[model samples]
Structure formats: C-alpha cells, structure tokens
Target: MFSPQPQYNSPHNQGVVDGIISGCKSFCLQTSIHGFNHIAAPKRHWIERLLWLVAVATAVWGVVDISLGQWQRYRENPTVVTLEKDFRTWHYTMPAVTACVQNRTNQDKLQNAIKSRWNVTPESHPTKYLYYRRFVDVVTSSDLYHLEGYEEFANDPDLNVDLFELVVELMPEQRVKLSTAEQITTPPKWTPVMTEVGACYTVNSLAITDVALV
Candidate 1:
C-alpha cells in the first residue's frame, strides 16, 4: 500500500530541478564563450587617454620648435661667400697661400691674368670675359672660405662688388654648386691642345666655355 503511491515531485520541486538544469546550461555556455579564466580587456581610462594626448602634443611641439629654431639660425647666419684676407676657415685642409685679396686690384689682376692665359679678352669677347670672371670669382672665393655662414665683412658696400654680382647672377642658374676648386680633366679630343703649355693651362682655357656654355 505504501509503495503503491509512487513518490511524485511537487510543482515547487520540479521547478527547482528545472532551474538547476537551466543554470548549468547557462554556465556551460558562458564558459564556452569566455574561457573559464579569461580576463576581460581593460578599458582605457579618461586620464590615460588625456596623458597620451598631452605626450603626443608635447612631442609634436618640441619637433616644431626645433625645426623652427634651426631655420631661424640658418636665416640669421646664411650660407654665402665671405671675402677674408686670411681664409683659414675651410672644411678641409687648404694649402698656405702667400697672399690674400686685400682690394679690387687683386680681382683686376686675376681678370687680366685669365684674359692673357685663356685669350678671353674683354675687347675680343666682352660677354665671354664677363662670364669667365664671374665663374672664376665664384669658384675661387667659395673654395677658399667657409660656405655655411655670412661673414660680417661681406656686407660692406665697397667690398668685392664684382664677386657679389657674380654669385647673385649664378645663383638662379644653379651653377654655383661646386664647393671646392677642382681641376677638370681635358677631353680626349682636346688633350693635344694642352700639350704645349700644360693640363692646368688647358683646363683654365676651357673653363670659360664650359661655365658660360658659350
């Protein structure tokens, strides 16, 4: 008689059992989606974001300031020619010279010498001679001095007007790029013309035509 009535779960018990099963399933699903020990990705705090922004801004400002400072320094000190009598301010070792240009007379002498040696006389070819003198001054002046700063003496009104004119004229043409005096080798066709005097004389003779492109 006692066993005849099979034990039956009450509504509350059945509901509890169902709830346990549902809970277990939910737990399993959550574990599968996020590993049992997985750590959530941390969110960036507002303070951290603000600090990063500040750091980036500071770095950018520093770079801009440094760039502007360098530009200003370059402008203040420029890279132009300097007419120095003792010219010891070379980037490389230079040979000791017996004399340095003191006045316009030195340039005149040089011009006359170039005319005599190269036969580029002002009377014969005035235009050629003009360009020839310009090239000579540019090469000689830059070769003998520093090129990254303007010397105070270069700004004098009476100082080397011809030299200044030559540099200014050639700046637009991009022909004043050479920093040192280089001896140009004679071409095979012109080698015989220089045999009588020397290669040096030959190079000087052809320099006018080469530089002037005339």
Candidate 2:
C-alpha cells in the first residue's frame, strides 16, 4: 500500500486565502483610484473587466511613451553646449558694453527740480520731499516699500520727474573713447536702459539705431 498524499488545499489554507481576497476586495472598494473597484467587484461581468483592462493598458502605454520621449531628448542633447569649428576668417559683431552709475541720483539736482517744479522744500513739504528722495530706491528695490501717502504722486506722470531724464541730467558727463585698427574716434551711441541698480547706459546695444564699428 502507498503512503497517503498530503492535501495542499486544506480548509485552513482556504480560509487564509479567503481572508486575503476579502481584504483586497475591501481595499479596492474603498480606494480612490478609478476603475479599480469595477475590476475588483464580485458581480462584475467579463466584458466590463475587459474594458477596464484595456483602459489600464492604454494609460500605462501613454506614461511609457512620455517617459521614452523624455529619455530620447536627454540622449540627443545631454549637454547645453554645441560646438563647431570654422577655419575661415569671419568678422564678428562687437559685444555690448553696459555702464552703471554709482550715484543713482543727485540730491542737489533733485532738490532743485522739486523746488522749481512743485515749489516745495524739505521744510515746507517734508512728506513730499522724503517720498521723492526715496522714490528711486523704492522703484529699484526688490522688496515692497510702503507708499501709503504718496499714491497720488506715484500715479501722476506729470508730478514725478522722468527717471531717464533725471539720470542723464544728474549724471556727470564722462568721455568714452572707441578705437579700432583704423583709429576710429566716433562717439559710441549710449542708450538709456533701466537695470536693477536704477538707470544704466548701454553701448552697441540692438536698441541703438545705426550700430557700426566706427
């Protein structure tokens, strides 16, 4: 007589398996993920399950496709620099030169302007005087400064002096020399540009009209 074979599908093993299935069903039913509940539903039809399977497969394919595309882009352009060597002689455009003034505004010029334009002095109109004095700083600074009382002045274009005009008028005249192989002495056309440090001047900028080596 042969020895009796041990039963793999015992009642205890079946109970443990049932518990796991129950837990999974409960989790699927309560889960927020779409189509999971339908897939796990006890009374779900074969057709419904097939449709959900297709939808899941499509979603996975889409994600994989996007991942592959990004990987391809990275492989193609791993670094930002692209280099090319040329042996032929070529004339290159001049680089832009930017100049910033240490003193953003002239206090004397500002005082005079205010006195002439608004007929107000620090003694007479302390609030206006202080606001105007701090105006450039406020405008240039990254931090927000309180402008509670000077809203009217800030809003009115006529009340406020032109920033570029103020910069030019107050800025001390400086001589700029440009020399080339031919001893070009033509003055560089300076264009007013607003920078983080207030009004600045740039030479050989695209904004300047008729840019030439001379």
Question: Which candidate has the highest lDDT of all?
Answer: 2
Candidate 1 clash pair list: none
lDDT of each: 0.44, 0.63
The C-alpha local distance difference test score for the whole of candidate 2 amounts to 0.63
Q: Give lDDT tens digits, candidate 2, residues 80-178.
A: 323333424444656788776665555557777667666778999999777665664443221123445455455667555554454555553435555
Clash count, one per candidate? 0, 0
The TM-scores, one per candidate, come to: 0.20, 0.38
Q: What would the per-residue lDDT of candidate 1 be over residues 1-214, giving only the tens digit for each residue? A: 4667688869999999999967755664465443321222136576665665566567768989999987887777665313323355434432321112212124446655555445787888998777666555543445333443335344544333354333322322111112244332432121111121111112224433542311
RMSD of 1: 24.8
* Residue runs of model 2 more than 4 Å from their true location after superposition: 1-93, 123-128, 136-164, 171-182, 209-214
Clash number for candidate 2? 0
Which one is best on TM-score? 2
Segments of candidate 1 deviating more than 4 angstroms: 1-105, 143-214
